[model samples]
Target: MKLYYTPGACSLAVHIALCEAGLPFTLAKVDLATHTLAEAENGSTDFYAVSPRGYVPMLQLDDGSRHTEAASLLQYVADLAPAAALLPPAGTVARLEAVGWLTLVSTELHKVFSPWLWHKETAESTREACKAKVALRFAELDRHLATRDYLAGDRFGVADAYGFAIVNWATILRMPLNPYPALQAYLSRVAARPRVREALVAEGLARD
Candidate 1:
């Protein structure tokens, strides 16, 4: 499998998932600023050729089949290695709970951050609104995480990977994480995982 991704993007969640699953895969760096893939042999390829939406986190399987969307990719990679227990078994309430956390992180946290960070001309009011919404979500997460080590359950799993990816943005966006100590601690715990650390270094987000 080959995963096309932009460094520090939500694609990092999938990358961490792959590593945690102990899967063999190659990384293809996508220059989102140019909407091109930087290939060592081919120079560059139009990213749209992989996905019409021109987004990162496009996973191309060995058979030439492709999967998009960070949440879906997270589940796919986790399901690929059930023994890893990256996610709970499918068709169970526990699995749905994990999906619910992914959805919240993607929709509530990730979407709120994207516009403010990507759009330089975003209205001040809109930026403030986004910050307020993010704070509300963070507060909720903080309350939940105060008792649990992970989002889906007591063990680290796919939902925690997705949450960590989005919440890590708070530091880059200059958003204060001081108010959500539990959430902040959760991010630190996820970052400290050996597989996640490997994924971070592979994406050039970390050293060694």
Candidate 2:
């Protein structure tokens, strides 16, 4: 498969998931600023032609099929490698629980951080309100993480990968993570994973 992504975007979650699943794939870098794919790994730089929706995290399978959306892509990659245990067995409550965490992270966290925090033209008042809401959500995550090593059960899963991608935004957004020590520690633990570290370096987010 070939994954189209923007460095450090939510697509990072899918990238980490792929690595964790031991799936072999290539990456096509999407320059969101230009909506162009850099290095043209997939043969076309016109990201618009690749994805009409024009977002990163578009996974092109070997059979010429494509998958979009971060949460869905995360789950898809996990399902492809059941032995990796990136997700629990299908149709089980545990599986739903992990998937629910992915949805929550996507809606509750990822959506909150984007647009408002990412754009300079966003009104200061709007950014402040966004920050307040995110803090409340962070507190919820902090409480849950206090006694748990991962979002679902005790093993690193898709939700943890998705959560790390979104929650790590706190540092770049200058939002205070100091209030959420458990969440803060959670970030460290996720970052320390071998596969996660590999993804980070591949995307130039960290040193090799």
Candidate 3:
């Protein structure tokens, strides 16, 4: 399989999962600012043809199929190496709970934070409103995290990876994580993981 991603985007979640799963895959860097894959030694448009959507986080499988969406991509990578515990066994209530949190992080938290960064017009009242909403959502995450080491349970799973990826946006957006100590601690814990650290470094987010 091959993964096409932009540095520091949500694709980092999928990259972290691939590392945790111990999967062998290649990576193509996308220049999202240009909406094209960076040139190979000779330069090319192959990746663009594969994903006309021109978005990062597109996973192309060996069978010539592609998977998109950070949440689904995380689950796909996790199931590849179930023994790694990226997620619990399927059909169990625990697994369902993990999926639920993944959905919340993707739609509620991730989508909510996106607008503030994409549109300059949102810099006024709109951005403040979104930030207020995010604060309430973060408080909920903080409360839940206060008692659990991970979003699903004591063990790290797919949801935590997705959550860490999206919530890390707080750093770039200046969203102020100080009020959500539990969530802040959770981010720190995930960041400390070797695989997560590897993803961060690979994405140029951290120095080797």
Candidate 4:
């Protein structure tokens, strides 16, 4: 499998999931600035060929099929390594709950950060609104994580991986996390994982 990614983007979650699952995969770095794959043998920048929308975290499977979207990719990696228990088993309430958390992280948290942080042309009002919404989501997550170790439950699953990737945006945006100690602690916990650290270092987001 080959996982196309942009360092520290939402694709970080998928990278972390693959590592946690102990799956063998190659990394293809995407230069978001140029919307091209860096160091391609053919020197092709036509990332749209792999993903219609030209997004990161596009997983090319061994059979040459492709999968996109961070949330779906997370579950796909989990399903591929069921023995690793990266996610709850299929057809169970726990699994649904895990999906719920993943959805929240994607739609509610991840989307909120992208516009304000990535797009310089965003209106000031829109940026402020996005920050406000992010704060509300963080507050809710802080409360939920107050007594729990992970998003889905006591286990460190895919939901936690996704959440960590989104919430870590606070650091990059220079947004204060002091108000949400639990959330801050949650980030610290996930960052300390060996597999997560490996993914971070591989992506050049962290020191080796």
The best candidate by lDDT is 2
Lowest lDDT sum, 10 consecutive residues, model 1, at 40-49
Deviating ranges (above 4 Å) for candidate 2: 41-44
lDDT of 3 by residue, 111-143 (tens): 888757667877677787878888888999999
Stretches off by above 4 angstroms in model 4 are: 41-43
Query: Compared with the true structure, what per-residue lDDT tens digits does model 1 show for residues 1-208?
Result: 9999999999998999999999999999999988887875344488876678898889999998988999889989999999999888889999889889989998998899986766879998899999999999999999999999999878888888889988988888888999999988888888999999999999889999
Cα lDDT tens digits for candidate 4, 39-149:
654556667755777888889999989888999999999999999998888899999999999999999999889867668899988989999999999999999999999
Models, CA RMSD each: 1.4, 1.4, 1.8, 1.2
Worst 10 residues of 3 by lDDT: 39-48
> Clashing residue pairs in candidate 4, if any?
none
Residue 29 miss distance in model 4 (angstroms)? 0.5
Ranking by TM-score: 4, 2, 1, 3
User: Each model's C-alpha lDDT?
Assistant: 0.89, 0.92, 0.86, 0.91
Model 1 regions more than 4 Å off: 40-44
